[model samples]
Target: MGLVVSHLSIDCTDPNALAGWWAEVLGWERAWDEDPDDDEVGIRAADRSAEWLFLKVPEAKAVKNRLHPDLRPPDGSDQATELARLLALGATPVDIGQGPEVLWHVLADPEGNEFCLLLRTPAQVRADGD
Candidate 1:
């Protein structure tokens, strides 16, 4: 059988805070009890289909990420509304040479890990045959 993918892991300076921030952004919940001094923290989707683990690291992020998540809005939400909500939740825009006309908005979490907010919702994609 082919290998099954599990959780995505991220290295950060403060696991608890970063994990909490991501949980808020994705509407997920903590996977386990939070310990302020712990070196790792995790959050998972409500259905447990997706998960991300944050690992404590001594060094700060020094460059753009080689890998990052591209988020699309869920069925009931549109890109603009989701973008505003993400900004209000402490996400900052990042310009990684994507240029002005690109279909996605690059943004960084509290710890500078870059991710993209894509232009279309799932429903839009379905309707447009994209």
Candidate 2:
């Protein structure tokens, strides 16, 4: 069988708060429930085509995320716009070993999850030294 990505799960200190932060960042909406459980919260893409889940963990975040999500704007759009938007959503800038020549900017979520903003499109990611 082949594998396909379904959803991404993140562990955080506050599920509701992080979920809300992501919702604003992605322009998604939190799914409705009478009372969201203490351990989990979720946000669905505004069109309902994708979902992201956040789960509460007892320990503090201690290291960089080994895996990170890369976000890009549609073709013909510049990365500057996307960067500004993300910063407005509460993402903080991070150095993360990237040099000035790097094509992506490393950033941390409100809860310190490391993610990147890529200058290239998915179709162009196979090149070297990206």
TM-score winner: 1
True-vs-predicted CA distance for residue 11, candidate 2, Å: 0.1
Please give each candidate's TM-score. 0.96, 0.80
Model 2 deviation from native, Cα RMSD in Å:
3.6
Report how far residue 87 has shifted in candidate 2, in Å. 1.5
lDDT of 2: 0.81
lDDT scores of the candidates, listed in order: 0.95, 0.81
Distance from true location, Cα of 24 in model 1, Å = 0.6
lDDT by residue (29-61, candidate 1, tens digit) is 999999999898999999999999999999999
Model 2: residues with Cα > 4 Å off, grouped in runs: 34-37, 120-130
Pairs with backbone N, CA or C atoms under 3 Å apart (clashes), candidate 2: none
Q: Score candidate 1 by lDDT.
A: 0.95
